[model samples]
Target: MGETNVKLASINPDAQKARDLLRIVIVGHVDHGKSTLVGRLFHDTGSLPDGKYESIKAMCERRGVPFEYAFLMDALQAERDQGITIDTSQIWFKTEARDYTIIDAPGHKEFLKNMITGAAQSDAALLIIDAAEGVREQSRRHGYLLHLMGVRQVAVAVNKMDLVGYEQEQFDLIEEEYRDYLRSIGVEPTFVIPVSAREGDNIANGSKSMPWYKGPTVVKALDSFLPNAPLVDQALRFPVQDVYKFDQRRIIAGRIESGRLKVGDTLMFSPSNKTAKVQTIESWSAREDFTPPSEAAAGQSVGITLDEQIFVERGELISHVEEAPIETEVFKARLFWLGHEPLTAGKSYKLKLGTFDTPVTVQKVDRIIDTSDLSNSESEQVERNQVAEVTIRSRRMLALDEFTSNGRTGRFVLVDKYDIAGGGIISMEGYADQRAMIMATKSTNITRVEHGVSIEERARRNGHKGGVLWFTGLSGAGKSTLAVALEKLLFEKGYNSYVLDGDNVRHGLNANLGFSPEDRAENIRRVGETAALFQRAGMLAITSFISPYRSDRDRARAAAGDGFHEIYVKADVETCKQRDPKGLYKKAIAGEIKEFTGISAPYEEPDSPNLVIDTAETPLEECLETLVNYVERNFRV
Candidate 1:
């Protein structure tokens, strides 16, 4: 991948002469004049090779077809015959200020993947729209793709103005409509200019036909877009590609994605929390006894030896000790699916991000977004060529970063079987970075004090073994009601039992925490630890809370070990809303409450539970009897 990125820069031979080279991708609806605009830009800027224009004109005459600037870019005979671009094409042109590599991507729906391939490497974008036909569905889809791919610098070209008679009203209407759509999706167009790509109006020079219009020409806009900031100034992201051995020295090699590294700098490997100082920076050289460089910056591929040997492998991210990436087992992603089969929930796929690879499952399908109309719909599966937001889960903790935080490490592709099925950008919106919590040590001088009483003695005195019965479900699902009733029954039957209701604990123990996802995880963590202690003291701890995230629930299970029992109180959202015990559902539906589970927030159901009580359908007496029997069979001394 690093070698491929190196080739992208050398495509433009004039790169050495210009101060900066900006890669721009052009996309639009089919027949929106994207090719014509690109060809015209090259011709008007005098960047076309000698005799390249006349040769195309003669070919057009021999075929008895009209001459079109688009023919210059549609070089493939098959593309000219079909009159639609089928693949991505690259061209080089220059303005007085800087050089440009214009990537002309296909505008057809069937070729959208090719378009994504071209746009993914671009620094900025140029979106073309037809003035006469207005903004079509494909035009809106292309705009959304640019936003998803993280291209912020964009310019809109209202092409084929000749067909619209160079009227300012038509251009204004189209501009207003498209500008509103782009803004809704968090994209702001830098410029909106009207141009006739075939006639070369407003492309390289001002248009006299449209006297009332005032905007920079296409060439001027290309020159005005600023180059991206130097990647060396950002946080370090060095993903290990391989570990090598040379003359009894173990060297780790990788390309620096961002920031810099020098000898003696302490580097931390994420997801493992291992740290080592850089002993030496190694590079390939032909001459013997060559002096190795002491430092390396972003875009350089170099090897290094650690001060001391430790277990290290490929796919671990290397960063400064204080600026490490996020270590998490799950994250939210916005991805585009291109697989033959629809992307469905609970399906497993291989996720490839940077040098890391892991088996990930689709935890849930959040929503499918219609790029054409910008409407969201809940669907069980994402069809081919559709964009969807979904939750992804890995089997274990993985090192990564949020796309918004670090694009290089956060972007990933999903491999279905052996085929590349989808691509996405990562967002840790509702998830926690568990590195600090996992590695944190509150006190170093303290030791765990062992209890004097034996477990068997405590069980004999309490008449039952101590354990945690964790009831999890949506609000108004009868979790608290069932838990309290069970607590009373267990106490009357000569067993020590207590109920830890969500609201009751929130009033005191969790008073400092809010309903945010992060706070909720922390709350669950505290409750799990407290419940484990209760069990150790020979008491049955029944806990009731709407634990929405699976990872948090898993943490609670880990805390209690074999003493945890997951009791799923199953009830659909409609049933829960209909049985609003505390009127919380009504408030949530009326917008008075935000981030309420089963309404504004998400609730991930337990994949496998020890007990599933269908409170929505079963009678209270029968449910209580079933719970009593299960406890008698398992927990009785």
Candidate 2:
């Protein structure tokens, strides 16, 4: 659009300085002109690196592809070959008034996971729509995702105006429809511009072609756009990314998402929930008394030194003692399934929220929304690229907030076994209010078989208290053998003890379970819950299993609570086969068992085990002695 006196020089420098740089991501369906808009903006602003345009131009000619504007931003070879942006690309440009970091996101549905990754870091969004095509499936879906991601600021760039004959009616019609759609989902676009990115009309510079429709060019609109500052003055919330100890100082570095952080200010760390006073505020050789939530706020990296030597770690949030963050065991969230496989309930996966990664299970699927109609559908499971409202139960208690309130801590990604399959944002907290919903679904039936009293009371009764001795090793590595020996030793010491061997569980408890990855996850979940019950009943629960996945072990650790002790029954695979107590390894080699741990499947060794017994070199009694000693040291009252 053409607007007079809207030159770049007219922008206010003070406004630019006060506002933090908002990184906006432009995303839409394939052939939606996302790249062209970015390329035009760069060309209009004279920010294209020298010789880059000519290089892309020559490559396009040699490759027999058209010298299109999209080629300018397609840096990846796969993108150039496929004629589609497969990965998100970042480009830095400036308007007269403000600096902008534009992220060009991939448009293919297959790469939607990558798109979400890019969206996770963006402050706002620019949704591109084709004027002639109106709104496509991806155009609507991406907008929905942006809303779900909590990107409140949006602008629709209706491209291909030249193809539509620069018609005012076409632009207005598309804008009106999209605005209605946005309103339905609680999103409102600040501006809607009609432009031909290919022709460089009404982008960085105003075009003479659109005289009938007068509005600020894309660049001018961006420059004039005011970004909301971080609420640093309100309650302080700092999520610690890391705590480093150098020389004598303890340095904590993280983004302060909401409140202001200053030197000498006292902050409480969660999970541990310890309070520590800030010693100094430091960033890039600049020391200050206070730092506001500007572009320079929470998103920008900062470091601080605290006065106390508290037990602070990564994944813990720091806040004012008064507001103290909420810690919960289970919550409801809206997840977008991006994996090839369907997301099924009761399946355990790695849940990564903020900097914390723990095992979690999808308890139930509440409702699945069809992207085309934006209507809710009753579904048993959500397939790839589908969005669903699901209830998730974390293995460990987590500190989280609503996505609308705090995007940083509310968002989470689900890692299926090894691959990250989907992501979600916390929509509602506490338990679901629907009693019927809970009744319709099956509970995680962990048998609470009480021989007499509860584990806590029993531990108090027995002179030597009860706790879980988690034994992890290869199938034939004597995990069960050692556990049985330890159980007898504990029993002889007048302690109530029970050994939950893998084979024994498979016979009764996990009778329906198989060796598949999904089944393995369930197996571990059941075992963890059982161990938790046993620990509560004051009985020494010795669980011996491959356990295979680190996420599974982490879940067991959480379920076992404070008295959980992990013992690595370390033995090489070859040595394990030499023993071959059940000859299962031999059968596995004969293809009798598929997805066997240490063979077809993976086994993640505990990185920081409390006890490591090398059964390969050490004798049985020696290994048991080491484990018993370690357990006695940590769990003895």
TM-score of each: 0.90, 0.61
Task: Show model 1 residue runs off by greater than 4 Å.
Answer: 1-18, 48-68, 71-83, 286-290, 445-447, 507-511, 578-594
What is the TM-score of candidate 2? 0.61
User: What lDDT tens digits, residue by residue, belong to model 1 across residues 76-111?
Assistant: 998999999999999888889988898999999888
lDDT per residue, candidate 2, 6-98, as tens digits? 111111236546535768888988888999889888878878889878888898889887888888898888887788999999898776677
Report the poorest 10 consecutive residues by lDDT, candidate 1: 3-12
Among all candidates shown, the one with the greatest TM-score: 1
Model 2, residue 519: what's the lDDT?
Answer: 68
Q: Measured by TM-score, how close is model 1 to the native structure? A: 0.90
Q: Which residue runs of candidate 2 sit more than 4 Å off their true CA positions?
A: 1-20, 58-66, 231-234, 247-258, 280-306, 429-637
